[model samples]
Target: MNHRCPAVLVHGWRSHPGIWNRLAPVLSDTAVPFWRFDHTAMQGAGTETIALALRDYIRAKREETGYTGPVDIVCHSMGTCIARYLLEVLDGDAREEQVRQLVGIGPPNNGSAMAELFNDPERGPEVIRRLVGVFVPEDYDPGDDTIVQEFRPRSRTIAALRRAGTRDDIAYRILLGANLTATPAFFPVFSGKTWEFAPDGGWRTTYAGDGIVPHSDSLLPGAQVDVFPTDPANLARNPELYCHTILPKNPELVARVRDYLTLSARPAARTPPRS
Candidate 1:
């Protein structure tokens, strides 16, 4: 163990750390400090409530570690939103100073099409689907403030991070995956979107979608995007990574993530070329 600044991993909405069990092994191989949090309760909650819970955990973790240093945060999907909120919205000079980097995969920085649909005015009260909002707890009122962002410029959390102006302190990188690859089954995410299957089994990743999220919404701002090849088996079986196509394990992609993190953290070496 390096015993220095540790790294934390936060999973996205309607998910658990277990979802990344395979990915976690990859991080462990690199000896990076990996942490996971269960935020099933954050679904309907407002920012403040979520922030308070995260702040409490941060303080607790700091005390537990008994170390004074920065910590790296790695997140995926909606979890990216929570981690960003913690780093930026929660008050603390020490935190801003200590954070080494923020790396997110499929973070939906702009917001998910599903979220937009839920927040859509045309949907009205029917927008809040009973089955879909299970992860969101009952306490937090969805009718509160309407910033509608995780960590973008307009988001309260992102605004705070920018105001803190510790750009030199904490760095950010985003890894993007097409929703088609993230989806569990090769199906359209939005209603009324579907593919016309031919008499034969062969089919393409049509305009329909992976299942839950759209491709356009997956690309968030302020982050670099890395496209991963869809799981070959997925193409063969017509099953995507997830409804969002963000979860299917792609080993090649795992290697890429390892490379990106290691390179990002590594000190560049100078070479003396010979004639």
Candidate 2:
């Protein structure tokens, strides 16, 4: 019997299961089942509410499969936050659920600074305009976005995540992209740099990010982080594909995720070589 844990895939905000279309094949194996969780139906719902639904989905899957073994969770962007809330907050205290690994791609573990930027009175409008055609639609409104609000730097959801902390039993792996070329093709809005909130109450851009999530934002005390395309030439070759929105489909990133999910043990973090 194949005892390898099942893999659960979670898509980020404003994203659909299609994002995993490229990765699903690599992760597909006769022994390991790939379960994709679609949150599009709950687009306007809060993270907690969506997470509750996720809990129910997992429970139902377990009941249907009769597989009580640990499952590996692979999520992207905001979906990472939702998965963490379910694993570390809701299931943390009880320690009853079985989750072997939590792999997050371009996750906003420290809360999304972009969410904060969207609500900024001075910069919100321009930022929204820049991301309209690319990351969001022309009619996008952060105020009307409950999930976005919950992911802001100082939101209650972020606070709860901090208080709950990560579970020791689960291995955490984070994959982040670096915009080495600083090309607009990588991400036009921020020019390949990620938005970050400074301690002095100001916004700044940094290259140590995937044009959406800054390295600092995804860094957790115990989680291992790996930046993609250790060679700058690789990113220079196809800068557009390394952006936040398209990361899940990037071939190189998908391969790394495959290795992480299938490897017998957690590997050491791989940092990009300094230019």
Candidate 3:
């Protein structure tokens, strides 16, 4: 814990911080004040509620880490959307500059299977509720998925960041997998409705997907696409590593993310952020 304005890692949907277990130590080894936080706020808490809660959490983290100014946010999967909300929507560009960098891994920046689920009448109800139980209740609506609403190229989030934007001042990096497939975890999309789940056949998302996110949606149309593997995934066997949520397990992916967060970043000493 030596980096003053150390990096804070955020994990994605239906997942815990354990996903970064192997990776955090690597960040720690960087001599940065690295930590992972619980994502209780992102679940089904809706947009504004989750945003304010996360805004408070980030403020607390920055203060606790003794960060004098901006802090890097390294996010995974759906966590990227949360990070975007924190910087772009919650605090706006004025405060976003305090963010040194945003490293998004396996981010469905365009949207997610959850977006597909949230939009699907059959699956959206069960997945959108903040509470997870065996049986899904009758009525639920997550309003509008910020990912679908706020993350697009011309999106309020992106547009706002772009307006208050700075290339050198605030960095953005996106990393996504290509060995994509359909997520079977979602309830089948066919409940006899005009809205079909696998519009592209049994796939729960777009044609070129990472099992959880469409490859195309992984990055905003014009945003930096960063890097992709040399090979496309085998749709049949569908390697487990290609799954939307499996990024932390791969040494290569971890290294890529590690490098992304650490590149050109000078090291600083550890201290609780100033409140």
Per-candidate local distance difference test: 0.51, 0.85, 0.56
Query: Evaluated with lDDT, which candidate comes out highest?
Result: 2
The TM-scores of all predictions, comma-separated, are 0.63, 0.94, 0.65
Q: Rank the candidates by lDDT, best first.
A: 2, 3, 1
- lDDT by residue (tens digit), candidate 3, 47-72: 45555666777678767756666677
Q: Order the candidates by TM-score, highest first.
A: 2, 3, 1
Model 2 weakest 10-residue run by lDDT: 266-275
Query: Candidate 1, residues 198-257: lDDT per residue as tens digits?
Result: 237322233333334334444444444554343434444434443343442445455655
- lDDT comparing candidate 2 with the true structure: 0.85
| Superposed model 3: Cα runs more than 4 Å off | 1-5, 121-168, 180-207, 227-238, 264-275
Candidate 2 per-residue lDDT, tens place, 163-186, comes to 999999998999888876666666
